[model samples]
Target: MANSLVSIQILPKTKNGENVIPYVDEAINVIHQSGLTYQVNPLETTIEGELGQIFSIITEMNERMIEMGSSNVISQIKVLYQPSGITMAELTEKYR
Candidate 1:
């Protein structure tokens, strides 16, 4: 079971005022490549994994934005950590 649920909304400032959708797509790609369970929502992407691993992924996403020519990046993050364990499905089961 995962120990953390992290939802991040990355806003990357482009070099030439380019559209941000592509940059956002790339960030989501990074998360997808991580092979962790994730859900991509309209405003944010939520990931399920060990806390450390999730943070590492977040860092990589930021680095990717810079590498892709983002002048700066702002990440809005929300975390729910439980040492015992937690999963997105478990948490949203009632809604489903």
Candidate 2:
């Protein structure tokens, strides 16, 4: 079972005040390419994986924004970790 859940909302400042949807898409690509289980909500994305991997992906996403010419990036994140191990489904299935 996965031991952690991470949700991230990334806002990258666009050079020349360009639209940010494309940059956001690129950030999402970092998570998508990570090979971890994930869900994309309207405001953010939740990824299931080890804690280290999730943090790494967050750093990579921010770096990618820099590479894309973003002057700055802000990431809002939420994390839950269980050493005994927990899962996304286990937590949310009650509502589902």
Candidate 3:
């Protein structure tokens, strides 16, 4: 079981005031390549994994945004860590 759940919303400033969707999609692609369990919501993406790995993924996302011509990147992150282990499904199961 994973020890952390991280939700991240990345806002990347476009260099030419272009649409940001492409940048966001690239950031999400970084997450997809990580092979970790994740859920993509409208405003943010939630990733479940070790805390360190999640943070590393966030770093990669930012780097990717910059590589994609973002002048600046803002990441809003929320973390839920349980050493005993937790999962998104476990947390939201009741609602489902």
How would you encode candidate 1's per-residue C-alpha lDDT over 22-96 as one tens digit per residue? 999999999999999999999999999999999999999999999999989999999999999999999999999
Predicted structure 1: lDDT: 0.98
Q: What are the per-residue Cα lDDT tens digits for candidate 3 across 1-88?
A: 9999999999999987899999988898999999999999999999999999999999999998988888899999999999999999
Question: Between candidates 2 and 3, which one is better according to TM-score?
Answer: 3
Q: Residue pairs in steric clash, candidate 1?
A: none
Q: What is the C-alpha local distance difference test score of candidate 3?
A: 0.95
Candidate 2 — worst ten consecutive residues by lDDT sum?
A: 82-91
Task: Enumerate residue pairs that collide in model 2.
Answer: none
* lDDT tens digits, residue span 17-83, model 2: 9999999999999999999999999999999999998999999999999999998999999999987
**What TM-scores do the predictions have?**
0.98, 0.95, 0.98
lDDT of each: 0.98, 0.94, 0.95
Candidates ranked by lDDT: 1, 3, 2
RMSD of 2: 0.8
List candidate 2 stretches off by more than 4 Å: none
TM-score of model number 3: 0.98
